[model samples]
Target: MPPGITTLAADAPTLSAANTGFMLICSALVMLMTPALAFFYGGMVRVKSTLNMLMMSFISLGIVTILWVLYGFSLTFGTDAGSVIGWSQDFLGLSGIGVNELWDGTTIPVYVFAVFQLMFAVLTPALISGALADRVKFTSWALFITLWVTVVYFPVAHWVWGSGGWLAELGVIDFAGGTAVHINAGAAALGVIVVIGKRVGFKKDPMRPHSLPLVMLGAALLWFGWFGFNAGSWLGNDDGVGAVMFVNTQVATAAAMLAWLGYEKLRHGSFTTLGAASGAVAGLVAITPAGGAVSPLGAIAVGAVAGVVCAMAVGLKYKLGYDDSLDVVGVHLVGGVIGSLLVGFFATGGVQSDAKGLFYGGGLDQLGKQAVGVFAVLAYSLVVSAVLALLVDRTLGMRVDEDDEISGIDQVEHAETAYDFSGAGGGAAPRATASAPGTPAAPTNKKVDA
Candidate 1:
């Protein structure tokens, strides 16, 4: 996130116990986000698909951790290879680095940095699960994560954060992961959904969320954990840049939530719980890349804009005839682009770097640079992820059979359902019914709320 310290003190870099401890706590906070996301996404799908939705997010923790230890860290943070990737023999298997050896230019150990970054790697793939919920095969989704991270995530992480990375060298300002994580995952979600096709009876079914409380709980946890996610990206608090990021994160999220609720009230005539949770997330994504560089007031503008924009963008799937199950492309992809590009207008040139935004008299140069970073990651992740999804679909089969999907993906894929009603009736388990009241008995060409 912070990449590396840009300016060193007079003394040579040495280990700081304070920084190491702080980073360890931050890593744990970030690790909690994947499961929190599981709950958030899990509650948004039909009851029959709840467990499948949760598993899609949870599995990334297991898959990415093993991969990160083996080669993820090396390729992401190792020595630059042609400004496209990284390589380091010592970082292989994480076997060669000493406990006391610090990440270059920082006080924390290389292990600390690696683990911190690993949490990001794990969460990015999990973010895509929301888009493909209720229809994908469990094993096939696992296979996709395995191949996608190896082919797409790892190299992109290097390009954005690694030493001598082309984007970093070009002076693009991404304090966190607006490009590498959110846009990368959002674009991938678009690609996969394009190949996998829509869920059965997508627009015809009401498909209301089965558990709003779970979604709220998940959103609360994500908000708490995101403090660590944003502030800790600065690596340390010695110079107080992390503190500024912390404050900006809170300000922007609050603004986004309020803005989203307002928009929902105006457009839909009701402020739904889903809108609040989504707005909070939109704010979080919008401020991630710009927090360190923008003022607190600037964060509010960014969050408010992203909240209204993403709230409106979520309806595009319906208008365009693409079924993004949980609005991944709308929220993450659009929010990430807002945050990354706004840096060109809001960057103060006093906190993270000397480059000023257009609003600050730096002209259109930085904005142009930001656009290159955003679109490059978008195009690459979109094209590559589509190819990978197609490969998986053609071989292992990405979507379940139409009948299985109609019945329930959870029971078909995992033999478990989110809710069991056998004890209530002393009979076989009850099939999942539409949770929302007054849902139609049969599919119809009725308009459904997004």
Candidate 2:
């Protein structure tokens, strides 16, 4: 080989393969979250639609992955375009983008970062599906996710993470995904539940989950992978990445867990396993935005407060008569807003160069900024989500046929059972087979009166 050629190769801004490896691992770690989400959400629903709930999160693995590779990444993190959306410079393909080439100034490969973020994009919308569980049509849901992602998820992601996004330009500190992932998912969930209507017997039915163990497993995976989700935002293991975010993650989650259990005991008279899992998730959501900003003490406060607030918020479904079946709006949206606003009051000295909170003596200026960020995200998400819901309802339709829903999405939509007590061939006892082998049974085309 020519010496000149070797010199050129060395000089090229190629990311060291080692760095690429780390990022790919991180990406994989992040991707694991979607399935974990399936388990988390699947275990929360009634046994009838359990498989449908799990599939809701699982389908994202297939759908969003394709979208991200095609154009989702470009629309989100492409070059600086406008406060509204990104340009198509990254169109058709990831052309000119090299594995190992850094994004902005980060040490990891841009591809690695893109794929990792892809997992988050896949999971965020899946989170909303839980709100309308057991009642939505499988085909309608497939169509809805496709359309919703193109309109709502993509634009919101661009605004928060993309350079040209308005929120990014405003210096709002969303360290992880307070506004983008949690708030966006939460608001969309609320819109979906309202539009789809409630479950058949929402208030009166004993809708407890069938599998607490699965819920525990899902929550554990989520808590574990969250380190990558949040810490990996740094894009590399460089600097004090291990110390700062790690401590914040641990402390906040623990505090939130205790706070949630404590509240459950105080109010409901029993500290249930469900509350434990929910509390952990609440802490994770609360700390997502604030973890990189607040101190350990701040994280503790944030987590504890989030646990109590979300616990209270979960009951709103009963009060308002909106069936947010899985508490997506309650835990994620409410928790996200709490953390986002609290950071304005608790943000002292952490990773990003943001203002201090009220406790840190920064006063109302930062708090107001936090409020602006929260309300802007909430209002935008709600309006756009509602509009998108209306579009899907009109175009591809939204809710499932009433009979299909009453019979259960797992039996009607997927044609597969969540469990096989009979241990028949190929798993569960063979029920009536439907279209698409191994696919869940879908609803028959008989429409119910809207």
Q: Among these predicted structures, which one has the highest lDDT? A: 1
lDDT of 2 by residue, 172-199 (tens): 7788889989998898888777677888
What C-alpha lDDT do the candidate models reach, one value each?
A: 0.94, 0.82
* For model 2, the run of ten residues with the poorest summed lDDT: 5-14
Question: What lDDT tens digits, residue by residue, belong to model 1 across residues 253-372?
Answer: 999999999999999999999999999999999999999999999999999999999999999999999889999999999999999999999999888788899999999999999999
Clashing pairs in 1: none
Candidate 2 Cα outliers beyond 4 Å, as residue runs: 1-19, 424-450
- Structural similarity to truth (TM-score) of each candidate: 0.92, 0.89
lDDT, residue 375, model 2: 85
Off by over 4 Å in 1: 1-10, 424-450
Over the full model, what C-alpha lDDT does candidate 2 score relative to the true structure?
0.82
